[model samples]
Structure formats: C-alpha cells, structure tokens
Target: MHPAALAGATLGRLAHHAVSGLVGAALLRGASKAAPKAKPATRKAVVGGLAGGIVAARWLGSAAEEARLKAGDMLAEARSSLGEEAPPPSAVDIGGHDHDHEH
Candidate 1:
C-alpha cells in the first residue's frame, strides 16, 4: 500500500474514534441526570467509558501502523525479487486529489 493511502486510513480511524468518544460521553452525561439514585454508578460508567475510548483509539492506531510497516516490507521484497530493471508501481492518489493531468 502507498504511504499516502496508509496515512489517510489512519487519520480516518482517528477521526472516527474522536467522534465516538464525544458521543459516548454525551450520552452518559444525559443518562446520569435521568436517575438520581444511581448517580454513583453513572459516574463510574462515564469514567470507564472515557478511559476505554482512549485505550481503544491507541490500540487501533498502533495496529494501523503495524499493518503499514508489514505492507512496506512485503512491497520491498516483491521489488527486490523483480530486480532493479522492473518498472515502478503506478501512482495512487489516496488523498482524494484529481491527478489525471500533470500540474
């Protein structure tokens, strides 16, 4: 996979995690106010959920980085097997840019 594509995927995952965390927090906060007797449990749930979100995001980011490194290693091996005379891989625009024509 291309470096740009890997970067795009990582950024997309980070964005997803951020949005989910915010939504989770908001939901928990709202739920907390609905029941006065379970206030302690609500607080615990909110804290746990926020912490879990952080851990999950970090894990996902690390996984993506690992996958990117593995892909690069595989690509390098393939290129070496093909020898230096082989043509380069085609350009891929993972950033959503239009590259049909030269600038």
Candidate 2:
C-alpha cells in the first residue's frame, strides 16, 4: 500500500479505537455510579441485554439500509415516469447553505 493510504488507515483505526474506548469507559463509569452495589443477577441481565441490543442493531441497520435503497429505486422510477431527471451534483442544494460566504 502507498504510505499515504497506510497513514490514513492507521489514523482511522486509531480514531475509532479512541472514540469507542471513551464511550465504553463513560458508559461503565455511569453505570457504576448509578449502581454501586448491583446484584450479580442484575449485572448479568444488563450485560445480556447490551449484547442482544448490539446484535439486533446490526440486523436493524441492514434492514434500514435495504429499505432506503428500495425507496431510492422507487423514487428514481417515479421521476423517470414523469420525464424528470435528478439535478446535477453541483446544482443540488445541501443544507440550504450558500458556498460564497466571506469570513
């Protein structure tokens, strides 16, 4: 791989790791503070719920993505039926913001 690509990959991995670690640490700290004397069963149940939630999120994300893709297809077909084509990339307004702002 090119040095630039390697550096980019390394930076991406480091950023991901740093963010995940910070989030996980914050979650644990909050939970500990909220339940300093949690029962073993309660802890086990919380962990199980978190694990199931993570698994469910993956499937949910896939379903949401599939739905969005189908919606896009339908939209494209509808526009084509109406003898319309999408605006060019440069003509599309994103966030309704003008690009010619002066500092």
Candidate 3:
C-alpha cells in the first residue's frame, strides 16, 4: 500500500482505459461501414464503442488491481514466514552498484 505503488497503479489503469478506448473507436468506425445508413450508424457505433471500452477497461483494471494486491500479500507473507526484512529503498543496491557510500 505504498503511495508510489498506488499512484503507479492508477496511472496504469488510466493508460489501459485510454488505449482500449482508442482501439474501440477504431474498430467501431470500421464496422460502421457495413450499415445501410452510414451517418447515424457511425455515430451510434462510436458512442457505443466508447461506452463499451470504458466498461471493459474498468473490468480489466479491477482484475489487474486484484491480482497486484494478491501478489503483494503473498510476497509479504513469504517475507514474514522467512523472518526477513526488506531493505529500505536507499540502502538497497541496484544493477550491481552498492549504495552504501555517499555520492
């Protein structure tokens, strides 16, 4: 439940929604060409696609969030079971570089 993780998740969800909406709009625009009356059908299809995309994106985001939370919980349980503490961010090493010394 770190704030950074929460913000990242939020941004990821929004990205998913935006991408899906664009895809839906594109698909609907193509599909509308088959209709007998082009204008009205195109308009309706665009609207419907946008709405459906939003709903689909919401569902996808929710599922992803659930999985993320579950994974985090599992990791926490494993750490607790092993009686190990995670290092603080500043104390952790990255890419084989030691962070123990001041820059």
Candidate 4:
C-alpha cells in the first residue's frame, strides 16, 4: 500500500479506538451517576461488556483477515487460470472503478 493510504488507515483505526474509549468512559460515568448505590454492579457490567467487546473484536478481526487472504489467493488463482498478467488487488486503480470489466 502507498504510505499515505497506510497512514490514513492507521489513523482511522486510532481514531476509532480513541472514540470508543471516550464513549465507554462516558457510559461508565453516566451509569455511576444514574445509580449511586449500584456502582459496583455497574462497574462489573462495564468491565464485562468491555471484555466481551474485546473478545468479539479479536474473533471477528481474525476471521476477516483470513477471509481477505483467501480472497486474494482466489483472485491470483483465477488470474493465472485466465492466462493473466493481472495485477494484485492493491495494484488496481485507486479511482474507485471496476477493472474487471475488461477481463
């Protein structure tokens, strides 16, 4: 990937993480204020939710990465089958247009 695009993707992920954290903190604060006596339970719930989210994210992320690799492999296989000098997905045009129409 181009450096700029890679940087943008990295920054995007960082932004998402930062926002998620801020939102989580706000939720915990609200929960604590909403139920003064149930602070312990609220804390427990928040912790559980955060843990569950982390687990789910990891599972889903791995699954997605695997899928992407499989897809790339399939693409390369198909191109070779077609006697192609076809470029990899990343090497395709960045103009948001389908290059498959020619193939």
Whole-model lDDT per candidate: 0.85, 0.87, 0.85, 0.89
lDDT of 4 by residue, 4-99 (tens): 999999999999999999999999888767898887887899999999999999999999999998998888889899999658567766676666
Q: Tell me the tens digit of each residue's lDDT in model 1 across 9-65.
A: 999999999999999999988877776988788789999999999999999999999
Better of 2 and 4 by TM-score: 4
- Alpha-carbon RMSD, candidate 1: 18.0
lDDT of 2 at 78: 88
Q: What's the CA error at residue 18 for candidate 2, in Å?
A: 45
Give me the overall lDDT of model 3: 0.85
Q: Each candidate's root-mean-square deviation in Å?
A: 18.0, 18.4, 19.9, 17.2
- Model 1: residues with Cα > 4 Å off, grouped in runs: 1-34, 85-103
Colliding residue pairs in candidate 4: none
How would you encode candidate 3's per-residue C-alpha lDDT over 2-102 as one tens digit per residue? 99999999999999999999999999887676665677877898999999999999999999999987877787678888998744446635677766888
Residue pairs that clash (backbone atoms under 3 angstroms), model 1: none
Model 2 steric clash pairs: none
For candidate 2, report its TM-score: 0.45
